[model samples]
Target: MNVLPQSKHYNLTHYQQRYNWDCGLSCILMILSTTQREQFLNNFEAICKEEGFGSSTWTIDLCYLLQRYQVRHEYYTQTLGIDPNYTQHMYYSKIIDKDEKRVTRKFKDAKAHGLRVMQRTVDMDVIIKHLARNGPVILLTNASLLTCDICKRNALEKFGYAGHYVVLCGYDMDSKKLYYHNPEVQDGHICRCLSEAMDTARTAFGTDQDIIFIYEQQQSSDQ
Candidate 1:
């Protein structure tokens, strides 16, 4: 979280310095490392001191920090270090129908089973409770129409959602936010806002539906 110099002043050497530490090349090269991305402000100040610079800028270099964090996060997830608890939800064509407008009931069934596996780790009630105890749970959601709407219904009817697979790890109730991890960003963009994310997800899945699924949170552990 290094704050960028407000006066457009920068330490060209530190900025361009090649990292020679034990950190990964990406992290060393990147100004803000993902391991410390959450504490970006503090990290920025440290970087300034280490680089023999000062900060007097109106706005910090949040964009760069966010970008670098995204990259490190992706590298962490895709590699063997990905946490098993992290939740991920997505929807794809089930049967590859004539316009691919329909999902195969079989595939949908499998997805529901996957959701069950996720719940086995932590039921929706537990997830909500954890969120209440913790903070806003950052959730990564698959905003596709089939995923957001159809899958839930299918999950309820067929004993589980086969097309929609959800994984739960952390939650935040205050800001009504959920954290999720996805490996889809070209240069360091990851995670999506639930509000607008649903719309974008729907478009990716080829749908005109305005449906947004709400993952309810509870204050009590008792369901």
Candidate 2:
């Protein structure tokens, strides 16, 4: 039986990020706090310190943090290892090595802890499938292309890739819109963007197409 998928929405308490680089953590908290789990809800500062949050964080760090909290999820990234091409780019050249070392450590730690890391790019179809199956997602995206409130409020012109995190909670097929919580907002709120634009930001350069597809339980695929 073919079941037509309608708009899917999940309840969540928005968490506007506290720090410039903590959008990823804030997004994770937004989803987890909405659920029964509360371990991470009240430990924002502690988690940041433990995770060594700093100038920048990577997809691997997020996956490892999810594992640390015993949350079930699948980690996907187009890059199997740190991309050498990033170091050559002027925008990231200064911080690329520092980020590389940190992310490499997290990658090894996540694997050592038995998390399955998928070496693949995330696309719109995959995102839609996850939502259809009742799973929420947090993925890296280019803020410049995302064009959130800050972009419009500041009348900013899109130029370089500014990597940020966003949670995908729902989608309306009829409207061709994807809905998610944007932790970048000063006062957190659900953000809606065109599916095509969202995918473009998700797969943008510097993002590395990194994403975390979360399951609703613990140890769902920890083998």
Candidate 3:
């Protein structure tokens, strides 16, 4: 693993998600920096909506959004089909087939855009290396195990392991903590969880161990 940045030094602006389903999109906005986004952010939201974001923000859907903005990154996944945990989701029964088709089509579109989608698993070492290089990582995690305030407040945890995306900002080896920005809350920046909990929350069946390894310049007026 590469030398990790001190958690206190990783300073990405914390942009909270506006809705329960927009966490994935919000992660992208935080990575791309919302400062010069007067026009960029508007178009970003427009493209997100144009590409099936109003309903749900799937992993492949995020790739399409990044490609549209000329963002540099690799889309990684542990599965190439419908979310295996679809059966556990609230509306899974009605939307399994539809969600599968949508995921397949958008996946192909993401490829046609020349985005590199890597099919494999990622571990803590990989996440740390990217953070060491000052790159941002967007991770899919089970919200239930994350001890999220919003989840507790809304009784969302009752639904069980809802899949959510967060921006992994840094880690503290000494503290054995994984730090990330949970868009679900207003003070989501650098929210810390035990290293064990982080792995468990993200590697669950619903997650597919999905990750977006962004290789942007880390430049933004806001940062």
As for lDDT, the candidate ahead, 1 or 3, is 3
Note the Cα lDDT for every prediction shown.
0.26, 0.75, 0.72
Kindly list the per-residue Cα lDDT of model 2 for residues 129-177, writing each as its tens digit.
7877747889898887785433352215656877789998888898888
Which residue pairs of candidate 3 clash?
none
- Candidate 1 lDDT tens digits, 55-141: 211001111222334421110011121212222322223222221211123123423433211111222443345333332222222
lDDT of 3 by residue, 1-223 (tens): 5444555335677888877778897887777655544455666566656776556778888887777677788988987767666766674555665567777877766667798987889788778777666477899887766653223433343566677899877676778776778887765546777767778888976788999988866443121
Give the lowest summed-lDDT range of ten residues in model 1.
5-14
| Candidate 3 C-alpha error for residue 175, in Å | 1.1
In model 2, which range of ten residues has the least summed lDDT? 147-156
Q: In TM-score terms, which candidate is top? A: 2
